[model samples]
Target: MQTRSKTSSLLSAKAAAAASPATTPRPPLKPKPFLQLNKHATTPLPIQEMNWRMERLTPPPPAAAVAKVALARNSPDAPKVEASPLERRRPAAATVRSKQELPKNPPVNWEYVYDEIKLFRRMNSAPVDTLGCGILASPTLPPKVFRFQTFTALLLSSQTKDPANAAAIERLKTQLPGGLTIESVLEVDVKTLQSLLRGVSFHMKKAVYLKGAAQILVDQFDSDVPKEANEILKLPGIGPKMAHLAMQFCWGINDSGIGVDTHFHRIANKLGWVHTKEYDHEATRKELQQWLPVKYWAEINPLFVGFGQVHCTADHPLCHKCPVSDMCPKKDFKPRK
Candidate 1:
């Protein structure tokens, strides 16, 4: 009877607690400690201790200490030292080369050279007959016939003395009634023409070339010279220099090409305007045209030829009296007085 009474009292107490509105709250959880990725040891350090150690991490050695370490290392014991932050970073000055280290052929002040040519030309007499110059000096012929004459003069002039070339041209004139013309040259027997051109350099080959070139002109362009550069280049014994000379002197075309003869080539190389060991005129002509302005073309050949003949001769140039000696590089050249 007593046990049944106790059970009934316990049930009544549980019911009273279940009916109550207020209850106890749960405790807050603690945050997990962070582990560093760089930590390598098996036993992990506590968060506070690890953070404290990170704050006091070792910094890079001072410059003096680095120097001492580098000095200590020698021979096979020399360690490959890593570059410092400053050293590893690119230097600001590296982007541009120093003025002293720049290419040897500095930009040419062409105007200065142009001024020199102008001054020299004004003071000097007319240049000696280079075949092209001689042809240009002739009394103007009819346009229809002048091209052939100018071209032939250029062909006959190569390696021939100026007097010899002039004499040969005079002989050719005697062969033809009017003047040296396409029909006149072609009509003359090759052997007769060769004999007339006796004093000229390579007369035999040149005579044959002259006849063949005139024949081509008559057949291709009706005895007229073609104004186009490509067409002019197609003729026998005609190169860029000769064709261009004809264009300028005969056809009144200017600055279309540069005529580099032996004198011009030698003088240009000496001036440091061109750098080449080649003794060929054709090669020098191509190289010089790269830097030489078209406006200067009219003056260059004349100035060089005149200077070469009078002052800057092949074997012994008169450097002491040369007008532009102060400005000339005089490369590979030693002047006599």
Candidate 2:
């Protein structure tokens, strides 16, 4: 009975242990590696394992040591590294040159130069004196027609030599039905206008501009060219130079501004009458207007243009023959012997 009773108690204890929660500890799970290696590795060891071995073999320098080295390298006492030849030859950033300040008083004797130029122009007749845009139109045309013809001539004169510009004007005068009038320009097709302007530069484009300008004139200015500079500029292909010239030739008004073409721009700079860093005609015009007398404004264009055409030419100027050669500074000019 005692043995049976002990066996029964053992059985009861086993049942109780089975019903309770488990007490045995489980083994820890392995953590995933931070880096992954490719399966296509040819080395005996995985790439990640090789990296780990290298890291263990040579540890990084201490943070304090790194800071000290950086400080020493950046110190003023440290020697600078010499640049290589290519590095030394590298172009530096480009700097913009500012506009030059013009002198308060004339740099040279402008009046003397002016008189010499007038005398030189009178002695030698230039293409501008005869075939220029201002005189190209026939005097027989009515006042309004004459004005329109003068404006047309100026438009045709852009980037074209006086002879070619004159030829184109003659073609328009003869070929067009109404003789270069605003109505004739409107009536003629663009192809016909382009053909008439064959010798002129950018003839096709100028032809288009002519047609457009004529249409605008009919719509706005009572079929006549605008008298004011601002209104004249409203037309296509007309700039300040053309506008000022038109005002002078058409309306006999010269106080608007100087008609600064390439010749005028070049002569003014060479004479030291105006100081400009570049070939900026507008800047030259403004500088000339500031100091030049108003009475000479009307005559300067023709005088300088003729002078440039005859003596002070673009290439190999005849400085020996120049009237004011002794007084001239001859800026940026090497005269012919």
Candidate 3:
């Protein structure tokens, strides 16, 4: 009985131990090795590695230093760099010149001319707008009448003075059956026309031309003055100067071509705007157009014509009293006492 009781107690103890939770076993702690405090032997790193480290640490050089380096590279003492053939062949930037530096014609003092024109406009009151050229003067007349009258006046004014041309135009206007209309001019006999135009220059020849011009207008252009400058040139006795003037006065066409007369040519030459040896009107016209701006086309003819009449005459120009005397170069001038 004692042995059985001890065996039962041992079994109960095993069951209790098996039912309780099991804990993991702890790891063994490692022991640290001993160290000695000794002085380290000083030694340099590889040259490349040391250089790389120094470069990484150093700051960049300044802009002035970089520019000096570039300039030194291009200096004569520096080694020459051979350029490629193509690079050597390439053109450099072209040097452009101003018009003033390379002038085509004798350079005009345009500022002085403009100032002189303004002064002439103020000082001289010679009825340039109203009575200088009778053709340009009578714009108030009827369109057809204006055209015919202007043409007739230009024809009569070839070598005639202003007052005499005015008188001739007046006589023809009153004496003609119906007036200076194309029909009236055509109706008047050549003999009667010559009588009426007796005061003007080239009266006899102009009388015949008047009839021919009237006939041409009647046959072609429906008795109306042509708008085209070329068409006006087709009519007998209508030259470039007359045609351009007529177009400006009658149809208000300007700036296409300038009217170059003796007075205009003289004034332009005298002002040194044109440099032509020959006294050719057409050549002077082209030269003036090349140099002078387009705006001066219309005003130049009338202004110079009026000025030529009063101050800058063909025979004896009044240079002392002239407005542009100080500025003008005064080519081929002969002063009058």
Candidate 4:
């Protein structure tokens, strides 16, 4: 009976304890020192803990010694390495050449040269002075006929000396029925014309040119030479030199251009009036027209031609006796003994 009473009392005390609630609360848990959080975790970490973790995990900067060495290498006052012999001997980069500048003013005083030439021409008379194609035409012919004769003389003068050309013109004037007029040149057969032009250079070829030119003149220009320089150039055997000369002598137009022949070309280059390649008369003419005064155009051709014939002869220029010797550059000239 005593054992039964003790067991009943113990059972009653356990039931009463199970029914009662605890008053005291449990403390919060501390995280482990080495614990790592998952990178894809849903839970957010505190700001201070996240900052500490970032600081410990980041890569460090370059070493101070390495940075100082790099800075020294790039410094301006650092010693330079010497180039090899081959590197030093290597050709420099090719530089572009600047375009040649056109001269604003002529090199020499042209008025002084012109005056000297005029003086020299007064003492010496060249074949061109009397026997030139300009004067070879007959004064007895009609105005239109006279111009035609002048044109014919110029055609014959090419590659032939003045004396020979004058003789040829005289023969044509006396031999041909109409005396070198457009009708006479057209009427004469090529062979007969060739025979008449015996002393002229390329007489046979010139005969064909004369006949063709006469036909063109009759058909196009009404048997008269064209006044325009461009129209005159359309004729056979007539070049820029002949066209310009015709304008000056035939039409009395002086400002057309400077009629540059071999003599004028050589002297112009020798005097340093123009810079052009040898035998480049066209370039010489352009350069002269660019700088030369318009007032001197009419007389320059005759003046230079006469000077070239006497003192400034092509093969042997008389440099010692030249009136403008002091002013002349005498380009490419060798002192003759």
Candidate 5:
């Protein structure tokens, strides 16, 4: 009975101990750190070893993602969206383009040019004088002048600008029918001369001068325009420049006397060919004559003049689409509203 009681007491004690609250012990675990991705990487993820315990605890992904995987596994004909072309992508470090190189024409000073060509101005300009001067200088002079017709052109050019210049010469050929000769011009009186020169500037003065010039040509130069620059310069009202122009365009004088004009000097200085203090029509003529080769000599006046007249003027130049804009050294000339 005592042994039985003792055993029964031990069993009751064990049962009571089981029913009571008790402490539970746990194992120690180490914490791990994560990794960071860089800007160059297309996809960023930390590399990890998936333990069975951790993987089993995680839930499955969405059904749509699962469907995508299944489709990739099954059908090879699905629409393939290609990424960017390999050549188009850079290696994340190269800053400049590798293929296309820039043009390296001599730099023009565009700042002053822009300022001069701006719309607003304080100076008063006569339209006829300004535009007429440009027109006179605009025509491209041929390198070699060889014919009487050429000399005739120079003779007819007094006080006449473009369309009128061309018209007067053509009309004289028809009306007088002596091919711009001194005799033919002398035959036409003041009235006829005025009528012929009606479209030109200062017709009265020009008519008198034209008659005198023609008479002088007949009496002095033997109906042939003087080929010598000195002789042409000595004639009435024919200055160094006019002589130079006539010699260049009528008698083929190439290596001497660059006929400088307002357009030439204006455009050159504006483009920073020379300082304003050091620049003038004569100086610009000398500098450009030195710098620009003879091959481009004939082209300079016409191109710059036409461009000056139309796009780049004393006021208001259209510089936005200029071909040489990229090559300009000083490009900080912003157009005003």
Candidate 6:
């Protein structure tokens, strides 16, 4: 019984020990590894672009730097614009140049001749338009194939409308019985020229002029028209104005003729280029010759003639639309009421 009882106690103690919770030792807890960034990380944006650059360029205090840039963009006290190297160079040249060479309204006076040339800007601008455009309207009036032929064309042009001149020219083209040149005119007699140019302005008188002019061209200058302005002026009926205009319009000589037609004289007197008691075309031409650059002198005739015919005229002028009106010398000029 004692042995059984002892066995029973041993079994009970074993059962009890087995039933009690057994504590297993946990593995030693290791500290977590520290976080490490890449070799060279940067902000998502670049530091050199405009916004970034401005920000980075700010002085020690970043807030103050931003404030400076803001003040700079908005400041009324800032200079108008950065001066160019050419602007810096101009004063030296201006001081050296003679006053006669420089116009008073230098900024707005490029197209004007010496002091006489005036660019009349348009007023009452609906949008934009010009009188200068009328001057350019007759580009096709004088045909290019026969540049020398322009002399004859000009003869046809006097007192005749452009279309009339064109019609006369077209008719003459068919009747090239003579070649419409001095040599050609010399080939045919005065009667033939008069007949061919019958409908053109002053046909009979022009034929006489043609015959006279042609003989001079043949005897003195050979068959060719003279290119030099002075040499051409010597031809009969070819005055300085005509000679210069012919050289320029016919042969593309830029500097020469004083283009003083009735229109030019009228416009000029109106513009105050020459104050003359006579207001004569010839006198005005001579007067302008002194002031305008030899280069720009010849162009004035065509320009004024064109301007007069189309825009400013003997009748009602479209002054509100005149291109050079702001600086016009005409007595009629007044601010539109």
TM-score of each: 0.63, 0.68, 0.65, 0.67, 0.50, 0.53
Give the per-residue lDDT digits (tens) of candidate 5, residues 108-216.
Answer: 3232233332311111122322333223332343222123344444545554555676566556656775545566778877888778766766666766776787677
Runs in model 2 lying further than 4 Å from the true structure: 1-102, 335-337
Question: Which has the higher TM-score value, candidate number 1 or candidate number 4?
Answer: 4
| Cα-lDDT of candidate 4 | 0.76
RMSD of 3: 34.0
Off by over 4 Å in 1: 1-110, 126-140, 335-337
* Runs with alpha carbons beyond 4 Å of true place in candidate 6: 1-147, 277-279, 329-337
Query: lDDT, candidate 5, residue 133?
Result: 26
Ranked by lDDT, top first: 2, 4, 3, 1, 6, 5
What is the C-alpha lDDT profile of model 1 across 199-295, one tens digit per residue? 9989999999999999898999889887876788888887777777777766777667887777888887676566666577777777777766677
The most accurate candidate by lDDT is 2
> Candidate 4 residues 72-142, lDDT tens each?
55689866655344223221111000111234355435565676677556546777889988898767778
The true-versus-predicted C-alpha distance at residue 127 of model 3, in Å, is 6.0
Clashes by residue pair, model 1: none
Model 4, TM vs. native: 0.67
C-alpha root-mean-square deviation, each candidate = 29.9, 28.9, 34.0, 36.9, 29.9, 24.9
State in Å the error of residue 89, model 2.
52
Q: Comparing candidate 3 with candidate 6, which one achieves the higher TM-score?
A: 3
- The residue pairs that clash in candidate 2, if any, are none
Model 2 per-residue lDDT tens digits across residues 1-337? 9999999999999999999988986879876543322221122446776576555334234435544544555689977655344223221111001111345464434554576566555446678988999999878889889999999999888878999999999989899996889999999999988999999999999999999999999999999988898899889999889999999999999999999998888877776677776668889888888888888888999989877877778886777656666445673377455
> What TM-score, to 2 decimals, does candidate 6 have?
0.53
Clashing pairs in 4: none
TM-score, cand. 2 vs. native: 0.68
